[model samples]
Target: MKIKALLAASVAGVMFAGSVLAGTLDDVRARGKLNCIINTGLAGFAAPDDKGNWQGFDVDFCKAVAAAVLGDANKVSYTTATGKTRFTKLAAGEGEILSRNTTWTFSRDVDLAQTFIGVNYYDGQGFMVPKKLGVKSAKELDGASVCIQTGTTTELNLAEFFAGNNMKYNPVPIETNAEAQELYKAGRCDVYTTDASGLYATKMSFDNPEAHVVLPEIVSKEPLGPVVRHGDDQWADIVSWVLRAMMSAEEKGITSKNVKKLAAQDNKDKEINRLLGKDPLQGLSKLGLSADWAVNVISQVGNYAESFERNLYPLTIVRGMNALYKDGGLHYIPPIK
Candidate 1:
């Protein structure tokens, strides 16, 4: 009788663990695709082409996650979420992950019941103005009419920047980036402000890109990355590691073009071998992914650096803070082993 009781207890514990793991991974597999939330329409970040195919840095992150989970990068459905709706959509389980350019704020992590995962983009708030305005510095834009997106940190930052300079300005608040761009271009506002990277994207989309100049001052820290729901740890691990895999691939000189060849070769670097699945990646099977998960990511979506160069670099923005830590940037990744 004592032996039977012990056996039953052990079986029950194993069943419980298996049940929990299946709850998250099984749902994704059963659905046949990953639901990823992205920006509404920010160029070089998340935007749909004329053929309705999503393409950008944030879009690549979603594709990488899909590849890690489904072994097919194309198996992802993207949902567009604005600044006001991104968090709510994730909390409601509208998507498994959010790859929008969302900042990792303290309140957002603990109070909002979400995990930020990691920072993919190190950004700062900045302002942009038309060259016709002749504004040499952010401080010189005193009493200027400013166009800012509502429901973003930019509104608050704009207030503080102007106040800190002991100046007052008229604020023209809008809901979306398109609206803000219209207001600024139509002369309703003298300046527009947002993330510095966003400023570059917006200016590049203008009729004459040379007409606008982004201010030199950077005001706030905006560490942007992917996010997942709070309750599902297994799902979070899958998504978080997908991002880290991209960053790690970039760090180790693995790219889309070289991924297949490198995966076929034996190397002395244990981390690289394990990451490319030459050796067993211990935690991957537990995450409901194959040992070749990083291989799927690099082959499909490329590395972090590839995604950036393809999307943002074409717009002429420099990779100032987005470079790997070894390359004088902040893109550090955890070891796969």
Candidate 2:
């Protein structure tokens, strides 16, 4: 009976695997576009502009994938999802890739059956309070009402922080950043907590930005990046390598402004040559992308550094821990060859 049960489980696994492998590349090709899920709205991450064009750091990653596959960065349909719905949408096959500012956590990585492609933003949970509250530190916020997003690492992190500090506070849980911002502005919550970068973006969106201040406490590591369903190895490789290509492009000093010109330059550096597909970006073509996939990504979306500075710098989120490892931070890419 035990052996029969084991055989049944094996057959079920194989059937599940077969269904998942059923031609995502062909679907994308036939649709002539890539469907990418992004945050409902987060400045410097995945928010749409006044013209309804999606543009931000995360948005660029999606465009990079689209460019690498379809040879056109604009060949993408952006689906906006909140924290509570992003994973469910992705798992339901609502989108090919989710480029929202999602953190890489143990449960989400292993138990949740999702593949975090790479860390595009290294962040931490922080608190933002009204300057008038006279609270200079997160430690002082005992019994305070904190606005937090439900269905996020922030929720767990907030609980751990308060428990560790031996403090009690009211949690005003909301579904989206927009709702949280409203609750915060209405004085419904004493503090708004999320990733440090997200807090900055939210604070800046307020009418009187100077009235709110982000505390210096970073409670949890929130390494935000792209993700996809776990079963598709081909899709995972395509997304993973796109992010790596961007990071490596930044490390190698290849920017969108000069990518075309640089692509025509000599192959003095083998790494650069391999990355730009000037000399076979090595096994990347097997993923159904052109030899110049990296070139297309760099030219269309710019390097990782460029994308960050474009959206994040404006909100005062400097490149501190998010900088490449060679530049004295923790950003590193796997080898192209």
Candidate 3:
């Protein structure tokens, strides 16, 4: 009976692989566009621009993947979701990639059967309050009402932070950042809490951003990145490598401005040559990508730094921990070889 059970499990595994894992690439190629799930609205991350085009750091990552896969950065159809619905939408095949500011948690990574490709942004949870409250620190808010998005780590962190500090507070549960922003503006909550990046993004959307102050107490670490469903390792590798390629291009000083020139040259840097497809890079054929996939990604989406600076720099979000490792940031790109 044990042997029979083992055989049944093996057969199930094969069937699962055949059904779910296979054909992601083929489906994407046939569709002629990459379906990316993104936040409903977050400035500097995934919000639509004034011109109605999606453009931001996270949006650029989606574009990077589309460039690598579909050969056109603009070949992406975005589906927006709230924090509670992003996973469900991704699991239901509404999108191929979730490139929002999603945190990598054990439950979501392991239990939800999703793969966090890599950390694109290192962030921490913070509190934002109107300066009219005159609270200098988070500790001063003993009985403050905090507006937090439901179905996020921010909810638990807010509870713990208040308890740990021997304080009490009222919870203002919200479904989306937009809702939270509205509640915050209406003074329904004394403070708004979320990832510091999100706080800044939300603040930027306000009529008077300077009226709010982000408290210094960072409550939790948020390792935000792109996510793909499990079972499609090939698809996962392709998306993961798109991020690596952008970072590698930045590290090698290959900007969009220079990638075209560098790809056409025969420089002595073997990695540079290999990266831009000047020379044959092994394993491209297996991934069903052209030799110039990295070239397309960099030229179209720009390097990671370019994307960050272009989208996030306006928020005054200096690349404090988001910088490359050599430059004292947490970003460390793997080898292109």
Candidate 4:
């Protein structure tokens, strides 16, 4: 009958989808490396070192996932992506995880068929101007030409903020953060607008960091985090828990310096024991990852705070909203037990 044919087609469609989604983990295992997408050059978030090795806060997350899944932190291949091409690259399977500082939004989550694991940084848009500009507040720049990155939430946020304030300004749009910095330094624009954390990072990269000041106004909420493609629940769970493991390690006082020792001994605390793989945590097997996954992440990548301090401290970015829940910040992860 017609109804039977329709049901068979629906079942076949689901099976095809499942087969495609299920291959990410197996493919990663077979290849022995994780292909992680990152920003072209965003200091303190994702940038290459002098040796051409990628290292930063966001880069640490990619390394952590590599450690968790592959048992080796260095077994990751980095692909630099601009804002415009990041999603397409991710959806096309060009990269397994996008660890760039991308904002989590409704359209990106549902419409684009991607899943944001969780917020790594709670950020807000702000304006930065040269100290010589003599502009103390964002509102003071009514006719200022603003340098912003194209294909980002920043462009839309800049327009809305200006219009809401009954202000008019010229937009100096660029594609990458490096480009924005170049134009801003060249005086092509009077102000540079981005996340406040990024403003500090940009300032640090300048010839004289002290010559610029980030204004106090926070224009929009940007809960930036790692992302993965949709239809792969197991892959999504693996990535999500890898991040949570870092946070939980920080909360439990396990650091890269002591993670190996902690993993070797039996701890009295149930959660610590389970997290360190002294006791088997159920459901890890379903994800096709080892029981020592959390141990690998902590020992190799350190915890969330460690990664943040190592990368962001040079930029003088404080742990305002990135601190743990007990420390009165927004980074609260679910219970590991």
What TM-score would every model get versus the actual structure?
0.92, 0.92, 0.93, 0.93
Q: Please state every model's RMSD to the true fold in angstroms.
A: 9.4, 5.9, 6.3, 6.6
lDDT tens digits by residue: candidate 4, 1-337: 9999999999976654542445789889999999999999889998889998998999999999999999999999999899999997787677899999899999989999999999998999999999998999899999999999887899899999999999999999998899899999999999999888889999999989999999999999999999998988899999999999999999999999998898999887889988998898888799898888988999889999899999999999999988998999998889887
Q: Score candidate 1 by TM-score against the native.
A: 0.92
Tens-digit lDDT track of model 1 for 1-337: 9999999999976654442222667777899898889988988998888898999999999999889889999999989988999887777667788898888999999998889999989999999999988998999988899998776788878888888989999998888898899989999999999999889889988989999999899989999989987888888888888888898888889999999999999978888899999988776777878878899999999998899999999689888888888888888777778
Ranking by lDDT: 3, 4, 2, 1
Clashes of 4: 0
- Model 4 local distance difference test score: 0.91
Residue-level lDDT of model 3, residues 35-145, one tens digit each, is 999988899998888899988899999999999998999999999999998897788787899998999999999999999999999999999999998999999999889
Residue 135 shift from truth in candidate 3, angstroms:
1.7
Pairs that clash in candidate 3? none
Which ranges in model 2 have alpha carbons more than 4 Å from their true place?
1-21
- The 10-residue segment of model 3 with minimum total lDDT is 13-22
lDDT of 1: 0.87
Pick by lDDT: 1 or 3, better one: 3
**Order by TM-score, highest first:** 4, 3, 2, 1
**How many clashes show up per model?**
0, 0, 0, 0
- The per-residue C-alpha lDDT of model 3 at residue 289 equals 97
